[model samples]
Target chain A: MSDTRIIKKRYIFMASVFIGLALLLVILPEKSTSKQLKPEQLLLQINDNNRYVSTDEDARKIIAGDNYMQLIDVRSPGEYVEFHLKGAINIPIDSIFNKDKNGDYVYEDILNQDVKINVFYSNGTVYANQVWILLKRLNYKNNYVMKGGLNRWIETVIRPPKPSVTATVNEVALYNFRKAASMYFGGGSVAVPAEDNAPAPIIKKKPKQEEEGGC
Target chain B: MEEVKIQQNTPRKYMNPYLAGVLLGLVILFSFYLTREGLGASGAFKRGVAKVEQIIIPAHVNSEKSAFYHYVKNGEDPLKNRLVYMIIGVFIGGFLSGAINHRLKLKLEHSPKITSKTRAIAAVIGGAIFGIGSAFGRGCTSGAGLDGMAVLATSGFVVVGMIFGVGYLVAWFFRKLWI
Candidate 1:
C-alpha cells in the first residue's frame, strides 16, 4: 500500500476509537449530582472557623459526657471490627452514598437526625475530611471531623507524653487531663519516667560574628 | 521491499518536548479537577493481573488471605476501574501521536550498540523489576512521579529522585548496552 494510503487508514482507525470513547461517555450512567457547595464556599467554611472540625481533646470531652454526639467510623468494616472508638457506628467510606437493603440510604437515618452533633473519624484525618466535605456540600449541619482521626487520639490520649520540668502550669494540667482520658479510654497509663529529675544540661551560646560592611 | 526501504529511510518530525510537557501538565491538572485522585499506570497492570488470577483461581482471588483480594472482594469488575480506562486512552493517544508523526512502525526500539536479543531480554527484565517496584510503591512513573510531583506529594519526589539516582548509578555498568 502507498504511504499516504496507510496513513489515511491509521487516521480513520484513530477517529473511530475517539468516536467510540465519546459514545461510551455519553451512554455511561451519570454520577449523582448532589447540591454541593462551591469550592470557594467550602474553602471559606473550612477556614473561617473551626466549626467543621473537632479536636481529639474536644471529642474526648464530648464522649465522656452525655452530649448528643454521633461518632461515625468511616473506615472499612474489617478495620472497624478490629478496633474502633467505643459507641462509634461503622459506615464504610465507599457506602456513604449507597442505599441499604431496605431501600433507605445507608446514612440517611444517621445524617437526618437534627439533634446529634455528627462527628466523623477514620484511621487518619484524610477520609474523615472527605466525608466532612461531602456532608458540608449537602448542607448537612452539625458535621465535624475528629481532627487527626484515630492516629491523633492514639498519640495524645492513648500514649500522652510527660511534661518537661520547665513546662507551664497549663501544660502540666493538660498532660494530667490526657492521662485521665487515657485511662477512661482503656489505654493503660504509659508510665512516663521522672525525666524531670535529671540535671539540666548547661548551654553556652556562641559569640555572634561581627557583621561585615558591604560595599 | 521498496515500501519498507522508503519507510525506514523517512525520518519523521517530532513534537517539541516543551510543548508535549505543557500538554501533559494540562491533562494532569484536568484529571485532578475531575477526580480527586491523580493518574496511575501500575494500578491498571495490577488490576489486569488480578483479573487473570480470578479466572485461574477464583477461590484464591476471592479469599481474604490473598493480598489481591482486597481489590476484588467488593465484586467490582477490575476492567471497569478508572485506571484501566485511563490506560486504554493512553494506548490510543500514543498510537495517534505516533501516527501523526509518521513514527508508527513494527520494530523493537533499541540502542545501536546492543544486539536486538540483548535489548529484548533487558527490556523484559527491566519491565518485570519495574512492575514489582511499582506494586510496592503503589504507583509507577506517570502515576507516582509526574502526578505525585504535580500534587506536591513527598512520595512522588522521593520515588522520582531514587529512580533517577539509581539509574545514573547503574548506567556506568550498562554503558555497553547504550553507548
Candidate 2:
C-alpha cells in the first residue's frame, strides 16, 4: 500500500514536469525563433519601404532610384571587394553571428540599424537564408535574401559568353579578378560600379627577346 | 524482474521545472551570444533523414528540386553543420543533467491508464506527426517556436500558437493516449 502510494506520487510529479515543459514551449515569445518563410511569403512581406529584391536587375533599379533599400552582401570581405551588386555593403555570413572576445554577441553593431530594408546576398541561398532567418529572429522584420546568389548573377546578370575550351584575354582578366576578389572577400565578390567602377586593365606585353639565353 | 528493478531502483529527483527552465533559457542566451543563433534539434534529424535517403535512394536524393537537397549535394556534409554540433551539445547537456539527477535509464515512461504497448504506439504516432509538422513549420518546439519567441519574432509566435492550439484542440480525442 505504501509502495503504491509512492508510485502514484512519482507519476504525478513526472506528468507535471512534462506538462510544464510543453507549456513553456507554447508560451515562448516570437522574438527568438527563426521565421520560416516561403519564398513567396517573404517576398510579399517586403513593402516599398522594405523591399526584398533578389536579382541584379532589381538591385540595379533600387540603386538607381530607390535610396531607401539597403543592399547587403552576406559573403566574405574578399568576395565583396571583387564584384558585388551596386551600392551593396559587405557583411560575411560567419560574421553575421560573431561574438566579441568575451564571447558576448556584439549588440550595437548588429541590432541598432534603423534602415528601411535590409537585403542579404551570398554565393548561394544557404548563407543568405541563414542571415535572413537570423535577422528575423532579431526582430528585424524588414529583411530580405537574394535568390541564387552571385553565381546566378554571373549567369543571368553578367552573361559571360560560352568559351570553346579556351580563355580570351578579357575573360582571363575577369576570371582572375573574380578569383582574387573571392579570395579577398570570402566567396563571390560584389562589384558595385559606383565603387569598383573600373575593371583593372591587364597589362600584357610580349616577353622580351631571350638575349640572355642566346648568350 | 527487470520491471521490478526499475520500480525499486529509486528514481532520482529531477531539478525544479522552473529552475531547469531558467537554466535552459540561459543556455539559449549564451548560445545566441556566442554564435548569434539559437539552439536546434530538428535540423539534425532532417540531415540524418537526408543522409539515409542519400544512401537508400541516391537517384531521388540527386533529383530533388529543393535547395536543401542541393545543399546536401554540394559536398556540404549535413552532419558537420553547426546545428548538428549544437545537438551534440544538447545531448550532452541533457544527459549530464539526467545523470546528476539520477535519471539515467532506458525505461519507457507511461501513464497508469494505458498499456505499455499502447504507449509505444502513441509515442511513434506522435513522433511522426511532430516530424512532418516540423518540416512545414521550418523547425520544432525548441528551434523554431521556443528560440524564435525569445528573440521576439512574429513567425515564432505564430507557429507556437498554431502548434499548441492544434494540440489542445485534438487532445480531447487523444485523451486515452495520454491519460
Give the winner by TM-score. 1
lDDT of 1: 0.74
Write candidate 2's Cα lDDT for A154-175 as tens digits: 6544553344458778777665
Clashing pairs for model 1 are: none
lDDT of 2: 0.66
Q: Give me candidate 1's interface root-mean-square deviation.
A: 21.3
If you assessed candidate 2 against the hidden native complex, which CAPRI class would it receive? incorrect
Candidate 2 per-residue lDDT, tens place, B69-173, comes to 753666556566678777788799889978665578888889889989989998999899988888888788888888888888776899899988998999999
Superposed model 1: Cα runs more than 4 Å off: A1-215, B1-9
lDDT of each: 0.74, 0.66
> How far off is residue A36 in model 2, in Å?
30
Chain B vs. true chain B: TM-score for each candidate?
0.90, 0.86
Q: How well does candidate 2 reproduce the true complex, by DockQ?
A: 0.01
Report the C-alpha lDDT of model 1 over A1-215, residue by residue, as the tens digit.
69889878877886787699879989999997666778889888877547545455554655576357767789998787677666667778898889778865657657644556677899888898888777777776677788788888778877888999999999998888888777767665333221223222222232233221000
TM-score of every candidate: 0.48, 0.46
